[model samples]
Target: MPTETEREESWLTRDELEDVRGRVPMLYVIAVPVRVGEAGDLDQVGLLLRASDTGRMERELVAGRVLYHERIRDALVRHLEKDLGPMALPRIPVSPQPLTVAEFFPTPGVTPYHDPRQHAVALVFAVPVHGDCAPQQDALELAWLTPSEAASTDVEAEMAGGHAVLLRQVLAHLGQTL
Candidate 1:
C-alpha cells in the first residue's frame, strides 16, 4: 500500500480525474474473495465494510481502479492486498478475463451499479483466499458469511452500489444460488 503522498504523486488529482471521467469510462476490477473448505466447497463469502461519502457504513467488494501501466491481474492483486492486508493469500483465477462485467453509472437510475464519482467499467472476479485476512485502511471490518446467509435480505440490504447483485452473480457463477 502506498502512502497518501505516493498515491498523489502517482495518480491524478480530483479536477484532472473529473476531466478524464467525462471523456471516457474508467476501467476497474472487483474481487469477491471467498474461503473454501478442504472439500472444495465455498464456506464463506468475504464482504468488506467501509464508510461511504454519506458517512454511513456500506458493504462493498474488494475493488479499485486499473492503473495506466497495470494489467488486470495486477490491479486485482493490488486491491486485494490494499483491502484484505498483505497476509491474505489470494488465489487469482488462471484466466485473465473476468467472470462478469459491471457497468457503473454516475446517475442513480442508469444501471444496477451506481458510482456518483465516475462512470466505471468493472471486470468482476471471485478469488479464493487461504490465509489470514485483516481489513485495512478505510475498511471497518471483513465479514465472512455463508452463501445462504449472504443471500439473505438483511445482507443484501446492507450492501450498497448494487454489489448485492454482483454477489449473487458470483454465487450463481460458482453453481450456487439464493
Candidate 2:
C-alpha cells in the first residue's frame, strides 16, 4: 500500500489547506464525459454513483475541487481519472472555456446548486471518452444513459443536489429539450 506521504502528494494535505470555506468560494470543475455516434450526436451520458458526505448514495457528475496551482483542464482530467478508471481515456475539450459556471452555496435557496460543505464555483464541461469506464474509489457505479433517458423525470429525480439541472443544461446545450 502507498504511504500517507505518497497519498498526500497526489492530493491535498492538511498543512497546505486553509479555512477559506467560510471566507471565500472555491473553484471547481465539473465534467460530463460523453460518447457520440458517427454523426456527432450524443449517444450516452455518464453518471457516477457515490456516497455523499451525508452518507447517502447520490448520483453526481465527475466533479472535484481545483488545486491552488492546477489548471482547470488538468483538474478535470485528474478528477475524471480518479473517478473513472485510469484506463478510461477522456477527450478533454480543445477550448478551455467551460459550458457553464455553477455556483454552489452552503445555504439552501441561494442557487440551483447547493453544497452544504462549502461555497463552490464550478466550471462545467461536456467531455468525451473513447475508452471503457470502470468506477473507482468512492464511485460505486458508472452508468451510461441515453440523452432522452437521462432527461426523463425518473432520472432527474434520482439526482441529488442540483446535478439534475446540470444534466438538463447539458441536454439543452446538445439541442435536446427536457
Among these predictions, the greatest lDDT belongs to 1
- What's the CA RMSD of model 1 in angstroms? 5.2
The candidate that achieves the highest TM-score relative to the unseen native structure: 1
Candidate 2 segments whose C-alpha is farther than 4 A from its true place: 1-18
True lDDT of residue 150, candidate 1: 83
Q: In model 1, which regions exceed 4 Å deviation?
A: 1-9
lDDT (tens digit, per residue) of candidate 2 on 1-178: 7876554335545543456676788999999989999999999999998887779787889998998668888898899999998888998865577889999998999899988878899999999899989999989999999999888888787788799999899889987775
* Cα lDDT tens digits for candidate 1, 29-93: 99999999898888999999988888988888999999887888889989999999999999886
Q: How do the predictions measure up, each by TM-score?
A: 0.91, 0.88
How far out, in Å, is residue 97 in model 2?
Answer: 1.7
Q: What does the lDDT read for residue 47 in candidate 2?
A: 93
